[model samples]
Target: MSLIDELVALHGVFAAGEYSYRGDRFSYKGHVSEEHARMASIMCRATSMGVHMQADIMAGSYPECGVAPAGGWVVRGPQFTVCVMANVFCFLDNQASLNAVMSILRTRLADASSDLI
Candidate 1:
């Protein structure tokens, strides 16, 4: 089966707001919104991995604001962990060049689609 197929199989699992897949597990962190849940479902479906799909609630910007980081060991409290954040798109240019580049990068890097909102 395709990776997306595998991920979609877990729609119920992710929509429930917290689940584990492949090896990465994600918790929704707060009250789950439909937008977050749907986006999370699509990401996992495309990547066959779980992801944290919560809002960026840190002083107007969230660390890891851009595309889900390429898997790395992030030590928050001395424990190394693999984390992914939803990719951010900056529509700064009138031609939308920045967003376009990011969209391509996301597709190439994570095998995920652009989260155009």
Candidate 2:
């Protein structure tokens, strides 16, 4: 099965999708709307950019400045938690299932990045 399929197969995952850095959704599965997925990607990218900018400004001078890097982000609500990493987003209901889902997405993102090198 595809990665998106695998993502939705995970326990507690209700929505999943792949989006572009420009906030355009390529594909999505589950109950999430394309608009929501696109917005999530844009928000995460913006946050990541801000973090990188701050890190660059403090680079060299502060050794610990870049220690905490922004990558993926998780926003938890009362019934669901949204995870945004790179261009992938997943909505999960159980916090306990986050670790497994995150691991899968991290590996997928890493593999995709390596292809660009």
State which candidate has the highest lDDT: 2
lDDT string, candidate 2, 35-75, tens digits: 77666566665665565566556765776764434446677
The 0-to-1 C-alpha lDDT of every candidate, in the order given, reads 0.33, 0.69
**CA lDDT for candidate 1:** 0.33
RMSD of each: 15.5, 3.6
- How many backbone clashes can be found in candidate 1? 1
Compose the digit string of candidate 1's lDDT tens values, residues 17-99: 33344324444432347566556544544442222332223313656566343321111223211123233211121222333
Q: Give the Å error, residue 32, model 2.
A: 2.7
Instruction: State the displacement of the C-alpha of residue 69, model 1, in Å, after optimal TM-score superposition.
Output: 25
- Give the range where candidate 2 is weakest over 10 consecutive residues by summed lDDT: 108-117
TM-score of 2: 0.69
Positional deviation of residue 14's Cα in model 2 after best superposition, in angstroms: 0.7
